[model samples]
Target chain A: MLDLFIDLSLFTMLVATGFAIVKMRRLFGVTMMTGVFSLLSAMLLVTLDAVDVAFTEAAVGAGISTVLMLSTLTLTSRIEKSPVHTPWIPLLVVAVTGAVIIYGTLDMPNFGDANAPAQVGVAAQYMERGPEDMDLPNTVTYILASYRGYDTMGETSVVFTAGVGVLMLISGLRRRRRRKPSRDEGEVS
Target chain B: MPEIEYILGHLNYWLFTVLMMTGLYIVVAKGNLIKKIVGLNLFQSAVFMFYISLGKITGGTAPIFPLDMRIDPATVYTNPLPHVLILTGIVVGIATTSLGLALIVRIREEYNTIEEDEILGIEKELVAQENRTLGDAMGGRA
Candidate 1:
C-alpha cells in the first residue's frame, strides 16, 4: 500500500512538473522544472527497483544536465517568445499519439507481472549467472561491464565524438590564421 | 472491481503516456530552440521511465545480490537488462543535449535570433535575392 502511495505521488508530481514546464514562458523556470522532473522520475525508478538508473538519473539528469542548461541559458535568452502559431494542431497530434499508445498498452501485461515477457527470456539467465560470474552484488554492473562491454565502449566513443563536435561547432577551426598575418604584413608595408 | 484493478495495474503507463505527450506538444508547438531541447529531454526521460517500469517484478528486490555469495532460490530480483540499457541511454541523452545547445549557440550567433519563424523569413529573403542575381545571370533559369 505504501509502495502504491509513493508511486502515485511521485507520478502526480511528475505530471504536474511536466505541465508546469509546458505552461511557463520563462526559460529559467522551465529549465529548473526539467531538473525537478528528472529527480521525480529518479524517485519513481527507485520505487521500481532500478536503483542504478535512479542514481544516474539523479546525477546526470538533475546534476550535469541542469548545469549545462543553465550555462546555455547564460549564453542565450532567458525568456521564450510566445509561439506565433496556434497550439491546436500540436495538441491534436499529441492527443492522437497518446491515445494510440494507451490503446496499445491495453494489450501489455499488468505492471510488475512476473510472467511478463521482459522478465523471462535471457533476463532470467543474467539474474542467475550474474553473481556466480562476477562475484559482485550488483547485477547491473556485472552485465554492463562484462556482458555489454562493447556497447559501453561505443557509448564512450559517442560521448567523445559529441565533445569534439561541440568544440568544433562552438569554437570552430582557425582557417584564416595565415591570411591574417599576410594582411597585417601588407598593412605594415 | 476488475475494472478498478485494471486501472491501478496500468496507472504507471497511463501517466507516462501523459508525460510523453506533454513533451511532444512542447517540442512541436514551441518555437524557441532551447525550449524545444528541454522538451526533448522530457520526452527522452519519459521513454526511460517506460523501459524501467517494464523491468519491475511484483515482489522483486533491486537487482543486487547478497555479497556473501548466499544464493536464495526463493528471492525474486527485478530485471537488470533494462537498467543497463538505460544507463547508456541517459549518457547519450546528455551528449545529445550538449551538442544541440552548441548548435543553438552557433545558430544564435549567425542569425542574431533563435525564433524559427524569423530564421525562416531571413532564409526566404536570402533565397529570393540569390534568385534575382544569379537567376538573371542564368537567363532566369532558376
Candidate 2:
C-alpha cells in the first residue's frame, strides 16, 4: 500500500514538473521545479529500498547540481523568450517509451516481494559480507566508500578539477588588475 | 491511532517535497540569485527529511544507551545509519552553498549585475567587441 503511494507521488511530481516547465514563463522557476522533481525522485528511491542511491540522488540532484545550474544561469538569461513548443514527434516517442515501460512493469514482481528475483540475487552478499569486508556498520556505506570508492573518488576529483578551473580563471583576473597599475608601481622600482 | 501514525509518518515527506520543489522552481525560473539560494536550501532540506525519516522507527525511542540500566531485549532500537549519512550530507551542502555564493559575488563584481539576462548581454557585447578587433586584424591576412 505504501509502495503504491510512493509510486503515485513520484509519477505525479515528475509529470507535473513537465507540465509546469511547459506553462511557466520564468526560467528560474523551472530550475527550481527541476530541483523539486529531483527531491521527489530521491524520496521515491528511498521508498524503493535504495537508500544509498537515494542519498546520491538527494545530494547531486538537489544540492550540487542545482547550485551549478544556478551559477550557469548567472552567465545566461533568466526568462525564457518564447513559449515552449509541443513537438509532436518527441511527444509521441516519449509516450511510446513510457507505454513500453508500463507494459514491462507487468512482468515484474510486486514491490518489496520477498520472492522477487531481485531480492534473491546478490543482495545477500551485499548485506552479509558488506560490514565484515569494509569495516562499516552500514552496508550502503561499505558499498559507497569501499567497493565503489573508485567511482566516488573520480567524481570527487572532477569537482576538485572544476574548483581549480574556476580559481585559474579568477586568478588571471587578478593579474590583469595589478597590470593596470604597472606605470605607477613600476616607477617605484 | 494507527491512522494518525500513518499520516504523521508521511506528512514530513509530503511537506519536504512541496517546499523543495518550490525552492527549485524559484531558482530555475526566477531572475534573483538570493531566491535561487533559498530554493536550493529547500531542496536540500527535503533530502535531510529523507535521512531523518529513515532513522525513525515506529514506536522506537532515540538510539541512546542507559549505561547503568539493564537493557530490555524486547525494546526497539531506532536506526542510526540515516542520521550518520545525513550528518555528512549536511556538511557537503553547506560547503556547496558557500562556494555558490562566493561565485555569485565574483560574478556580480565582474558583470555589475546579478540579473541573468543583463550579465549575458554584457558578456556577449564584450565578446562581440573582441571579435570585431580580431576580424579587423585578419582583414590584412585575407
Collision count for each candidate, in order: 0, 16
Q: Please compute DockQ, using alpha carbons, for every candidate against the native two-chain complex.
A: 0.87, 0.08
Model 2, DockQ value? Answer: 0.08
Error of 1 at A48 (Å): 0.7
Model 1 lDDT at residue B119: 90
Interface RMSD of 1: 0.8
Instruction: Report the C-alpha lDDT of model 2 over A96-188, residue by residue, as the tens digit.
Output: 644554454445443323454543455435544554465554555555566566655665765566577567544555566667578657898
Per-residue C-alpha lDDT of model 2 across residues B62-102, encoded as one tens digit per residue: 44334443446576544444544554565466556656655
Best by DockQ: 1
Predicted candidate 2, C-alpha RMSD: 9.7
Model 2 stretches astray by more than 4 angstroms? A83-86, A100-106, A158-189, B1-142
Worst 10 residues of 1 chain B by lDDT: B105-114
Q: TM-scores of all models?
A: 0.93, 0.49
